[model samples]
Target chain A: MIDVGGTEGGVRLRAPRHRVARRAVLWWSCQAASRVVVLLAAVGFGAWWSPFPNRALVIALIVLGVLGIGYVTVMPWWRYRVHRWETTESAVYTAAGWLSREWRVAPMSRIQTVDTARGPLQRALGLSSVTVTTASAAGPLTIDGLERDVAADLAERLTRTTQATPGDAT
Target chain B: MNEFPPEEATAAPTPPPGPFEDWQRLDPKAVVASTALVVAPMFPIVAIMAVSDDGSTRTLTTAGVLLGVVVLTLVGSWLRWYFTRFRVTAERFELREGNISRSFRSIPRERVRSVDLTAPVVHRLLGISVVKIGTGQKAGSEGELKLDAISTARAEELRRLLLRPRAGTTPESATPPVADSAEETGTELARMRPTWYLYSTLTASLLLFTWAAVGSALSTLSDVFRALWAADTATDWLSDTASSVWTHAPLWAVVVAAVVTVLVGGLLGALAFSVEMWWGFRLTREGDATLRVRRGLLTTRAVSLERRRLRGVELAEPMLLRLAGGSRLTAVATGLEHGETSGRSDNKALLPPAPRGVAGRIGALVLERPGTLEDGAPLRAHPRVALRRRLSRVLLPALLLASGLAVAAHQSEVVPWWSWLVPLGTAPPAVVLAWDAYRNLGHGHRDEYLVTRYGTGVKRTVLLQREGIIGWRISQSPLQRLAGLLTVSATTAAGNGYYSVRDAEAEQGLSFAESCVPGLLSPFLEKNSEFTSESVDSLDGTSHERAKKRTDHP
Candidate 1:
């Protein structure tokens, strides 16, 4: 319900609703754990084989482990708080990224296609993501972490909008 | 879809025409020219061997083998020329080629965008030219069709026929009647100036500095001389003279001498290259709403660009070129591939290196409007925080290096105290560059075009059409967010399609985007004032206002 071009000025944008399932934290943590394990294994092997010194290896392992644990516990929540997406009659707005937040707006008339995808873990969690592709060089806009049914409904609505609007010239 | 009438269908439809009936072969001279080009590289090797006094049976046998290769290549090229053939029907243009595994392609007549004609010195003498047809597609050779070594007259005829607008099919066909009258004989748009060409040659020769530096190294120089002279006596004499000069002169003097020699040689080479490439450059507007550029001294190239496909113009001014008050203009258009055959990305360049004023005039003529791009309005500069960001970026690396060197000097006797001076010596120039870059950053819009200017080394001022932009991307780093700044990129289909205005205030960037494309971004921006009110009230008011505006506009 944002004003399009009012002298009253300034439209308040609607942010996306519905956070991803809480289990998403566990899924991301497991991915982070595998990387930490490889780093620890490398440092342990260096300590056993290198004749120069092992003190640095021990210090490195401790520092890395602390950082990894912090990242695993904290990053997903921060990402979920920042990521947002919304689709209106004329345009789709997507905001994403952790360190450098990026906001993109692609008009419905420019959209080439819309698709919904579900990975194995997402299927287990009953969550899905939708991708909106347009004839732009900035590439496609993807919104992840929605209920499976909601993702399907959004994708269908986007498809209908694109079909009704013509003229996607590249 | 329409079906045939029932009575006509019962009567039986006429059999369709065969695809290959009208296929025609290219001129036979093309086979000879291609074979000669392939064989040209062997001449130097053969000459070296001949001068080395190798008269043994092995030498004879090698010559015999080379002769066999030449014969085989000649036969192969002839076969290829015989196999390649093309046909032009009313609905489509078809090309078929290949000896073992063949490829057949048929492109619809409506999809053909432009046909370009070119001729090298040899081809020009032989009265033959190469033709390429573009279909306005984005990816690789699938978008292009080439026909090499046709009669020049036929190429011109084909170009005219292929580019003629189909009646009532495309809106572009509805050009004004004035253009129709001008179509009988094309009007000259722009021509190269010799003085500007000289400036372009000197500025473009900057790459030669790297080659000169590498060539001055003694080991590489000796290797080159040894290879060229071949005989041991010649190599010894050359090395002895070189070493004697090196011994007599101080090290710095020798370096200076080498640098001077390299610079002179490079300048001469660049001068010759520019003279050959841009000798007779000219741009003309044809009646079919196409721009045709003809240039090159020895190898002539004529490129045809459809006017409708051109998105805008880019003025690129390299630091040295800008100092000389010169800039080059490149067309921002789709289907213009960066081809390797020409040396300077010449396919995209509409105007050669010229004075800034001349470039503006030519750009206006090409766009078919005066004062469209060069509106003379002052551009809005980014916030002062942008300057602070640039300064910090430049100074941080220097500070780190100076500190690292100081620490090393303190810890080790081998580290010299004077080495710490390196970063200090570089800081002044770095600061100047950062300030210059900040000063150059600007963005503005006029009528249908959005103009942005940026760069430190090679300043680029791009004029892009507002309607061409398909979306907007707003990005902000954590630091940028703290400073209330963001970078906005206007995404289009032409060129790389990411034109950015960096370090602008977030609200300013959002408002610019909204104004450029109207409703596309207005609905998404959250005004600071609106957030103070209840969400429902703000939303309802905005939507209703938007609807009212739409109806009023309609």
Candidate 2:
């Protein structure tokens, strides 16, 4: 957590109040590792049956393996540093993405639904994701890699606020 | 707010609402129109079968099937006409439809946002039209209702009634506001110009359309020739010409001739299409401030939109059309868009490919303001790094590929000598394209409208209303962060859902976003409190805030 706002208003865009749970880094790395493993296995099988020369295959393998290992090692930590979310009395705000940082804000009156979902990997890691949808087709705001209890509490509070508010949401 | 008497509310949960009015049914002529439309395609099939000289049993069977289908269609349409009925109420519009699995649909009158009337050639001949009532809800929800084959006059009346405020609903307001008169009158806004068809020929879509048509025609012709194996005379003549034509002409000559023919055919096709599509194009501000567009030669369509639902206008200038000083106009209004991936929806077309001046003028008029697109606030240019990024997007990949090709060429005699030059040869054009795209990236505001312009092949300028925006999104890539550039998007329910100002300096974009929607981003900002507000304000905070929200929504 980086605290940039404390009774201070300014021109710069401050990070959201709370960062994603620390375990999110491990969870993300595990997910990436699984993908890398699957790719490696696929490459090994392809190389066994491939028509290409040994020299070419070796070069390709080296390039792919290095890239995969780098991605699996770096992406999770980078994402953890960038991802953050907060909910105020009037709006929901979130910052996400590893290579690209996307900051989103949805006011309470415009929010149509608040939903919480859990993947198998996330369930194993005791993590959940909360999605807040508005009428705009641009997309919903998703806060991934939150602690299970925190996500549930956030969803509950968001649902209550949306229900209390009045609008057509369009 | 329940308009029905107290006893009726107690009697039934969903009762027929109006006692003074009788239930109305679709025009009976719809049966004829429906039969004609369905049977028209089968006419050629029936004619071909009749003349084929096939076996008597097969011919008779085919005729029998056709007759049975027509009879089934007639019975279905009659049943539909007999069962369907609708009526207006003080607060709700109720409809009952279907004979087998009946349904009663009721919509609160105040929820209606648009009432459209469309009539195909056959329906036009019978003086009936299809009325679609949109409640402005997204994704064709329960708010959408359709009435097929009603008298056009009745549809016009319904359009007026549905759009105008009710009599007692605004008793104190009395008449409508000065700007929006509560009367059933039309103000002519724009009309079709004959010379505008010339610009249609300059569109890339004309080429696409003609190419598709030519391909299908060629394939169909080949299929017919293959089937005519027994008729040597037809096949022999075609084969003789195909074999000898190329022998007499050089390859370059043939290519030139083919290109010329295709271009000519495409232009002619575009001309015919433009004329038919916009034969009597007329845009008008009709009863209760609803915008109505009436067009088409054979199949006239009357599409309507509520003025309140209009969010903005989009001006599209495709490369060729822009070169010809022609641009297209589309309404960024709720309930106007239909179907995903449609790309082109005439219902939302305020003006076809016309002069750019005309498009901009009409767009401003529709926005209900008299200022030009850049009246007060000139569009601010994106950072120079944005252009550098665009150039790199093309030059980097091209350079890398060119180097690889050059290395491969040096290593082998089998590699073509020209392959290395190909990427380098294309770089100049790509550079030009990147520069064009960069030049087009701009964002500004004119009074109540926020305008953004982007793209190269088809530069689009969107003039979106500030109040219509529901949310905000700001994004920055890793590379952009290094360059201090970010993209800010305004999310609204109208026109593409979101419009972005791409690749602006971080602080410049944040401040622009803040200025566009006053308080929405202020609370989220953290500066010296110079251009930002510290604490978040609840929408339902106080009487003052509630009043501000009321004004904002309206």
Candidate 3:
């Protein structure tokens, strides 16, 4: 973990990077599964005992499996490759995007609060996600993929730091 | 003690036992009082339905009465309990309530911008007042420090602390000592035109009553016509009235008198409601800092607001009010939404209740100018930005409309001429809007303060000092990148509202904002990099010390 506060009453603490990764997987998995199920059902009904038959079914199944594998396997790899975190004395910046990349930097003083959340997959992986909220309505900035212990420690530290430096920028 | 000046000696006198340790719970009676307000409005329908003789309607009315009684009683009791629950510690004021998913809020004293004390007749008699501490957030955010059922003395003391100018924060020249002469002068409440004010405000109630009366009369007229169409006995009664008015002199006089009496009665009903609404309207300046407002008959409310809390001031001149140059001024305070001067308790107030001249005075006090509406503090922008804005506004719309017309003309066989007219119609407004936008836009700086103002219809200005700005962002679109234009926005803890300046200002504006709002953009604007967690070590103690030096004011 980076010492964000340094020596000048700066805020230090953020959810670990891995917890953010697991959440990204879970969020996309739900989306992918729904799309896959719909596609499979449509294929099954549309091809049901057609005259062209066995060879086509085999091809279709192969294609579906490959697609599912690609979605589950390839996407998480891309996210893990892209996901990054950096902390400054004043804020935490996390960037995640495949092609048209984006970044979110939330200043420690500006952060009103930090919320830690864990999904079933994340719990299994011992990971958690953290969301940093500011007074603005743009919504909270989220970092996924943190080890559970790391998540809790980060939350505690951030909470203490924020309370200590109350009325600062964040 | 050795011969130091009084100011120097009093520099650190214990900080006033901190943010008050004792906080009163909201009056238990308030639940009953507020619940009555919510329930009372619905009761009139029940009374009307119950008295009506229609058989099915009467049965429904009875059932409604039974249902309303149960719901009202249970909810009212629960609400009373919920609001009355609170605790105040030395550091914060905490409120815990809500049936499901209990909500709790802790408001610190430093965050409090202003403290308001209000009381109804009953609360006054009970020697308790409801205290509202405005946290400077916009409507619908929970940061109020409310202490209900408190004595007036405690309320006053708390208000003084909250209203007191903080050392090293408020400019030394901003607030001078209150003049003793002015403070001693007090206006008698009786001197205010309570009756005339009530009569004028009754206009609104009268308008509502007239709406109902006119609708009822029209329906009754339609019913009479329907009865005549069916040749019914009710129709025969109407015919008799017509015949009497036409033939018999005395009967005609009676008919005319009765018609006049009904009209007068409807008008009188309106007048009564209006009078009831604005019953005891009174306005007075309590202290040098606050304007005290007291009004209402059943539930009298007293409002004490600091002039500094006022955001935007408006002067409304209704045609009738305008005839006598009798303009009503309304003020919009930062956190407050309702401006019901008359404790009419009806929540739907279009404008704030202020004195006829108070809006101008309050406006001057808040903005340092009267009549001329000012927005946030001034910011800096390049002159070339106006040209870009004009181009975007005038050219974009013209291009889009012309293309759309060409596409329509090509696709559709009919209305070829109309399609070509699209650009012609859109051109004028686009030009005007762009011109207005150009004229209204400006940015400036007064040392620590970065002010930005823009808008044609309702000119909005946001004043953000380096200390007040929590964060900021500067973003450029593909078109904007090519055009050397950037949109920069700064967010403040004062509320979720952020001020923005677009098109005209780019790098300079953003750099200024970035300079003011520390830690907005950082070591993270990396090019062609992914999550490079190189652990930002550049922001050291020295940087923070520098930031503090830049931000701190004496």
Candidate 4:
């Protein structure tokens, strides 16, 4: 049975049953850093080759570069803290976000498909993401940063649970 | 795939073994309908060309091309009418067509949801209608079947047969099945009044269409000049006017002229379109359930929304229409979106712009609810911080932009004074709009409906059926958290699929979502739980870990 915490007492959703694989922090950091590194390199190269340097623009870019570095390091770490997933007897629940957080619950009956995906980077990190889709076009419920095997198991279990139900919930 | 030549292939009338035994070809008038489709657009151009002084080489060339098109169309229509065959068996509805690249589609009869019929003026003249069978298949339009130019009687028969309430599926269920026959014409719930067209004129679509027409006319004139090999002269003349006009006249003059022209032109355009679209508009309920909306002058549409698929209804009042006390009603129904074949959402629309009182009464009738909709439960207002957030989100940007433009205008040689005036003038309205939007922010549960009202520009109040909601999502940004605000989105299969009560107090939002669909969110929710997080230092762990330690606030 589920219970609601009243506002005066403080309302909240309990952390989902499980967190993503820990190295997901490292994987996501590398992922975020990769793009920022390219951008930083491009700006550095542009400044070095220019005959006339704009001091103001260069200083602004440096400030931005430092902030970008802070973001690349801090964001993944925060995302890891927030992203959690749980599958119950009747529903698949997930919470994910960094600066902003989103908590989504898709009933097992409403689920249309369950898939597991691992990109080359994720594969190298031994990580995979499980995606659960419902009839609504809003989007799929994804639990990212899981061990490949765990993702596969989750997908299998979801498929079985969904198949147990008869009609397309919609 | 248009090849349905079943009657043509009836050389052997022997009893067949499968459902394919009686492959029915399209009605004969379908060929004429197809041919007319090809000829209608070009006929006017050709007529004008034929009357032109001394048929030139270009005229002759155009005429020849059109004649060839007509010949090809006639041949194509005959093949299409001959090859397309559809048969409905007890188990499934199957359609087989195409000659060169053949394809077949079979839809299980159980998957069928609603059958809609449309009769354009041309089809109506020929006593035929277009039949679209909606199966509500999530994998796009594969489950939808469009049969062009079927007899009106057959179209009606198909609708009734396909959408008839199934055995044991009664209308009293939480989500009812389709309606059974109550009356021949059904009981009329609402009829269009002649004066409703006045509100249509208040809509921006009138001006939008008028401006679009002017834009196309200008482009066509330029294209003609290019075709006549007078492009250079036209370009020179255009440049000369462009250079001479703006500098000589105040920018406000041009704006006023353009506005006036669109207003007057749009009035006429709106009146014409309103009549064409909403003339003879009627909403009827058959038996206890299904709602049938019949409307249009040039193109009559009969869209059926089975009660089970009726998730909710939205009453949208655009700024102008709202000022005039008028609102448009649209359905939040499933399996009615036929966006693939026709870009327009013919089925979702329930009523054109009408008086707010009329729209509300009709909405209640359609939903089978007793009291007035929004008046049911007083929607909870957002925390005062929400007003601050909206002001910063909308009015702050406008203020900043106005200041930026003012500085740019003063500093730059090319920038005009009017550049700043535009943003500065818009600032007041932006503030007003922001306040209006804040006031409109609220959600409440009214009996079986979850009502949400938002948007200032359109200001829509949606009375979505609580049972229709498939899921709920609670989203928050860091800024939102700092402001103690969050958004709750109710995800459904109907309408836009998801509608949000944006910028509500975080606790209220969660509690609201929890109460609407009890037990769905409780296991995930914790009492005295703050959403803040603590750092976990075991990132290199071999097994899964719960990242944050839940802290209880004393």
Candidate 5:
């Protein structure tokens, strides 16, 4: 629904196949704000009976409040992207990013594992994260915030492809 | 390092094709054993509560507890049964399992690292065993892939397919055929003596547990004594009885103390034996390429580990064990880097514990020579970098504290002296730690292997081929800048264990470490392994800089 990259294929040309997830801005901002609020609440409660000036405390609170507000407001315009996975003849390509793009091609034969996980919040949103692992590789390619059906379909496809071509190196 | 020869293209080992043998359903005995172990610990408290003022069983509570145990036992048994499933496919060993969300995974014949067959004493009596397929993925990640409770003949066949070295069999020829036990090869591979290193660590760990148990026992005894002595009616009666008994037996206290010590010590020793025997162990080598270890008593495990996957071998002799000429050796593979990989519930069994002499035999079987076995010169700090190293060590604490004070002074009521103590107290330990670090640091090429030994009390020596290093990083901190030094860290596919060198030699060391890489271990782009012992030794020539400078302008 949200346009994350410049091209329809997104930004897969400049950066690694998986850049920072586009939804990370919204997710991380929410997380950072929640943490800040909890910290501030604890500090305020702990200092409730202290002789420290309320005026100074108010000023400090205001500063943090403004920063949190600014972050939530400007995060949408951040130069990040989301990846779309497409199956190829021998491999699967994952494309993402905005300013810098990355295209990762994992051949069907080399796929070691396909794991799909959905956090409580993501589950509520009907979204899941799928990580595709290749044997003898540095790290798995993770695509977060995909619709549940899409993630399931992708996982099934990768699994089928892996089984069909045993040791068919791309 | 010299270039490693190409791995010959041959049929990968697999589980021997056999008849679809369904594991005998787990007997009800496991439920009884589980209940005994879990329920016995709570008996004392339950008895105390039940034996009220007059001594009559609380009927309701007793029934409830019994019902709870029965329900727990059933659930445990069912879960155990549900997770165990296995099938032998044409080209892969496939397992389908899971209680919540079922998963089906298969390892291609070539991807199977090792297949291990283990027979627990009980299983052996029943002519049954478990087959463990060690895939390239870290150990234990797959919870129940093991073909558990299978017949002895089936297990042996699986072991042969997974453990035997490559012969002339090709992938096409490896198709599943009529299932049966593999023919017993006349020559059995050499068996390694149990690595005793785990024994010392075990002894140390058990001592702590003994102390805790003794403390708990003393406290409980004191409470019971106080309860009896403090009771008005019991005190007078107990005093009169004690007086009469003591008059007759003055040696009671000493006898009690002796009995307590013996009982406590026996309990401690028994607990240690129970744990040590958990994996009633076995170690065998298949050709030179694989080390087969079978351990665990209840959920018996057998791991056929590939020697090539080993990133490092650590042999340790604790202070106490040093006297007994005992050493412990740990053979670590890439799977070790990911803590959760060893899917086995018993983490300790991933590496079998063995005695020093036996560990040496293991090292030999895996084609590794621990530092103790090697004739390498003892490592020492390069004299030229010693002053810089010493100065650098002192500088870190001083700067850290000074900065801490600067930050504190700006915001807190705390004095700079308090902040300075932070660094001042750290200065000595920092120096000691740095000295220890320098003492333990050494990296050298051992033929095609890149060998590095470091660490103080728990010294570790990593042995990996140059092809193992995936990448290298050069890092410099502000403090390091003052010391005119940089640290180069090398990463291998195995993950965390890195080879780092500091001070003046870092640049050349980083280059040398990188040159060892066979085009990044990941994505495993097959290239001619680009290192040889002769080329590695060539870097040893002292005139490296001079030779480079001359060649640059030539």
Candidate 6:
């Protein structure tokens, strides 16, 4: 029985303080490793196809290697810095992204389902991601990089809230 | 409405042999009408065989085979029509059909969302219409039920009965009450205006005409080239005369002639298309709390929408249409999914292109409210940094194109040196468009409703009911962070499900979302004394005054 339209209209709200687990950096690095492999494969194909001299191929590979190494080393830290999430009684707020920061709020009543998932890498790192599905065209709101137990707790809370609130599902 | 006899109504009760007893068949003329489909394809095949060089024996065999297929198809259609039977009981509508594989479908009285009636030219001539019942379900064929041909009077009566609000909310207890208390008379909401139709036709027809003219001219040019290459001795005097005239005509005159021809053809096409599509467009509110729209000339249509399912109204104004002060209104109602194959035109359009003010007035009438969401307090504009962000976004593309052209010119002569200046030439228009987009960004709220306006090329102002908004999404990019801006999206079940307000100050967007739906975001909002005191103090006074005025006026 929360009042949804009776609050003061101009206060700037602060994002939650709970940062993603430190193991998230390891998880991100694992993903970056796959991307690095793809990039190297692409560079190798370019070297084979191009009519340019071997010197040009060598220079291209060297530059690509440096960029790839930089990305693998730095992107994880940037992603960890921006990732933040919190669950309230009526809604879940998540702020994450590296170059483009996205802050999304999904209300409990609108949530159709809540799922907690643990990938092979995430399982090894004791991390999980929680996804809340709604009818919104923005697609599902996912909060990645959470401790396994925390993700489970969030999923349970979301499901309970969705059931308690009496509203149309879609 | 009282066309049904009393004995027929009381013949079957609950827990009987079946829910339906007085089953009825479609109009007999339906078989004849459907036979056209079977006969249409055979005509060309039979003609080709008749004109073939093959002997009379082969031609006779082909004709005999075609005749057999046609006869079989006609018999199948007749049998199918005979087997299809429908019955309207007090609690549900039962449809029994199929000869080889008997199929039975029943739609509960409470689950029906709409009952639409359509009559194509042939059906209209036979004085029969098709009735389709829509249920808000995703099940394949169960979601919609169609009776191919039924008497127009019966269709109207069934529409009224099926769409009538049930006595209670639960489906189990739903039973036909005594006749509806309200009279059958409906209040006319809107009809197509001649001027609006003209503008609508002109907007689309002009483009069509241009394409047609270009296609014809290209074909003619190709024909002349082909004739010249062949150098046939059979070249007629008419062609010789035409070639002489073509050579004598100035290039400017030819261009002018083509342009004139395109414009005239476009105008004519627009007029014809508009007249055909919206010949008798009419929207009315039937007494049973259903909004019914009847339109189309050759193929008449009648679609009814229960008021309970309507989410809101969307006013769309495309760039050219906006310039002419025209807007289109569409109803965002559930169960009226804009599917690819189903020609459910009436389910979407509430009003065709019309004066913006007229569309607004009709929107208000459809919602049954004196003041709509747009009538609330003036919309709040985003921070000035938003304008800067948009301008940079526009400039970035232009800069990239200029650099790309420069690189291309340096590599090869394929690109002209002057092509690098193209970005500069486009800069002014891009900047102007960005400014317009920024100016259009706004969000506001009224009692139980939320209003959002945005878009540069196709401006849209939506007035959505607050209850329909099931969730909210707030996002910010890196560039947006520098500008202290965030985008807020209100998620609903209708239309695109998410309507966004772009480039608002982080604090402003959060506060706007919180106030629009109070407790949903407030619990998570960390209220700092410094920011709250500076921001909330000013906004509080204006919002309080507006809320008070709304209450008093309402």
The DockQ of each candidate is 0.41, 0.34, 0.11, 0.49, 0.04, 0.35
Best by TM-score, which number? 4
lDDT for model 4 comes to: 0.76
Q: How accurate locally, in lDDT, is each candidate?
A: 0.73, 0.77, 0.53, 0.76, 0.51, 0.73
**lDDT digits (tens) for residues B449-498 of candidate 6:** 67888898879888787887777777777788787888888877665667
- Model 4, position B346, has a per-residue lDDT of 51
> After best superposition, candidate 4 residue B313: deviation in angstroms?
0.8
lDDT of 2 by residue, B467-508 (tens): 888889999888999988989999887767788999987888
Position B31, candidate 1: lDDT: 80
Estimate the lDDT of model 2.
0.77
**lDDT, candidate 3, B36-145, per-residue tens:** 54565455445544555366754575667757775887585566565445543444556666566667787764556556676665566665677877675534445455
Q: Write the per-residue lDDT of candidate 4 for residues B251-294, one digit (tens) a residue.
A: 99978987887677778877887788888989988766578888
Which has the better DockQ: candidate 5, or candidate 6?
6
Q: Which is the winner by lDDT between candidate 1 and candidate 4?
A: 4
User: What does each candidate score in C-alpha RMSD?
Assistant: 7.2, 7.0, 13.2, 5.9, 14.1, 8.8
Q: What is the lDDT of residue B379 in candidate 2?
A: 90
Write candidate 4's Cα lDDT for A1-170 as tens digits. Answer: 23554343377767676778888988999888898888888887778777897786688679879988898989998998898887777677889988879989887778889988888899999999999988776747999999787788778878987888865435
Each candidate structure's TM-score, on Cα atoms with residue i matched to residue i, is 0.85, 0.85, 0.54, 0.86, 0.55, 0.77
Fraction of reference contacts reproduced per prediction? 0.43, 0.42, 0.11, 0.52, 0.01, 0.40
lDDT of 2 by residue, A1-170 (tens): 12333322235787665677778898899989999889888877788788865767667778889999999999999998878776667777888989988999888788988899999989999999999988777858998988887788778777887888887334
The local lDDT score (0 to 100) that residue B504 gets in candidate 2 is 84
Lowest-sum lDDT 10-residue window in model 1 chain B: B1-10
TM-score of 4: 0.86
lDDT winner between candidates 2 and 6: 2
